[model samples]
Target: MSAYGFEIVQTLIVDTEPDEYVKRAMSKINAAESNYLAGLVVGLRDSVLAFSMNVPGTTSKDFLGMVLVTQYFVTMKEIGALSESNPVFITHGPGTVKDIASQIRDGLLQVNTTQN
Candidate 1:
C-alpha cells in the first residue's frame, strides 16, 4: 500500500475552506510545515466581516484544521508532507479534521445476531 493516499491532484472545494486556512494549506504544501497546531478557537459571532489587503498572497487551499474558525495560533509541529494516514481536513465546516478511526474504520456492516 502507498503511504500517500491524499493525491493533491484531487478536485478542491473552495467555498467550504476559509481564506486564511487556504493560505496556511498552501504554505504547508509550499515548504515543510508542522503537522499539529493547538490554537485558540475563537467563536464567530455577529461581527462585521473585515478584510485586509496587506495580507499578501493569492487565495490559498492548503489549510488543515477545523476545531474552530478562529483557531490557528497554537501549532505544535508542522508536518512535512501529506501522508495516506494523515488527517484529511473536511472541505465543509469551520475547519475540523476527521478522526483517524472514523476516517478508515468504515465500510463494514455486520448483521445483528440473536442469542438464544
Candidate 2:
C-alpha cells in the first residue's frame, strides 16, 4: 500500500448549539494565521461539526499533526450535550480512505459504547 503523507480521512458534523468550548477554539483559530490547515472543526453547543482536509506529502506532516490533535482536544472539550463521551479522530492509509465513512461511523459507535 502506498503511504499517503497527510490527508484528511473524514469529516463529522454534529448539529447543535455553539458553546464555550467551541467559542474558545474558534476564537483561537480566527486570532491567528496558522501555517497548518485549521478551522475545519467548528465547536457549537448545539452544532458541533468537523471536516477533514487532506494535506498531501510529508512536508508539513509534523506541524499538521500537532495542530489537528490540538484542535481535536479543544473542540471536543466543550461539546456540551454531546459531551456524553469523548470524540474520536481516526487516521489511516490511502488503502483505507475509501472506507473512511464507515471507519468514522465505527469510531463514533465505539465512542458511544465506551460512554456506556
Candidate 3:
C-alpha cells in the first residue's frame, strides 16, 4: 500500500515546572488576547502559540510562531505576581483558561490572565 501523507507539526516548548510555568503560559495567552491577537487554538500540549494577525502566506505563519515565542518571554518576565487561585481562571474545555495555565506548570499553576 502507498504511504499516507506525513503530518508536519510545529514544535513548541513543553513546559513542566509547576505553578510558575502555568503563570508564564497564561501571561502569554493573556498578552496575546490583550494585544487583540487573532488566531485559533492551534495546539495546546505544552506552551501555547497563537497565530499572528497578518496573513502573509508562509511568512504570516512564521509571524504567528514569533508571536508565540514572544508572548512566552513576556509572560516569564511577570511570573512573580501570578497565583494559583485566580478567579479569572476557567474550569472547563481542552484549551480552557485554567488548563492552558496549569499545563505549562505541569498541573500546578491556577491563574487566569483574562479580565472581567
The worst-scoring run of ten residues by lDDT in candidate 3 lies at: 45-54
Tens digit per residue, CA lDDT, model 3, 38-87: 33333431223233323334464355445545555565545636776344
For model 1, what is the C-alpha lDDT against the true structure? 0.36
Candidate 3's TM-score reads 0.22
Alpha carbon lDDT of each predicted model? 0.36, 0.53, 0.51
Model 2 over residues 3-87: C-alpha lDDT tens digits? Answer: 6666766668665678989999998986675523344333321122122334434344354444455555555455634746566
Query: Model 1 residue 34 lDDT?
Result: 36
Tens digit of lDDT per residue, candidate 1, span 17-98? Answer: 5689789888987554333221112222212112223334423221212222233222312332435456745344323334
lDDT score of residue 53 within candidate 2: 31
TM-score of structure candidate 2: 0.22
**Residue-pair clash count for candidate 2:** 10
* Best-to-worst ranking by TM-score: 3, 2, 1
Position 55, candidate 1: lDDT: 38
Best by the lDDT measure = 2
Q: Which ten residues in a row have the lowest lDDT in candidate 1?
A: 40-49
User: Stretches of candidate 2 above 4 Å error?
Assistant: 1-59, 81-116
Estimate the TM-score of every prediction: 0.13, 0.22, 0.22
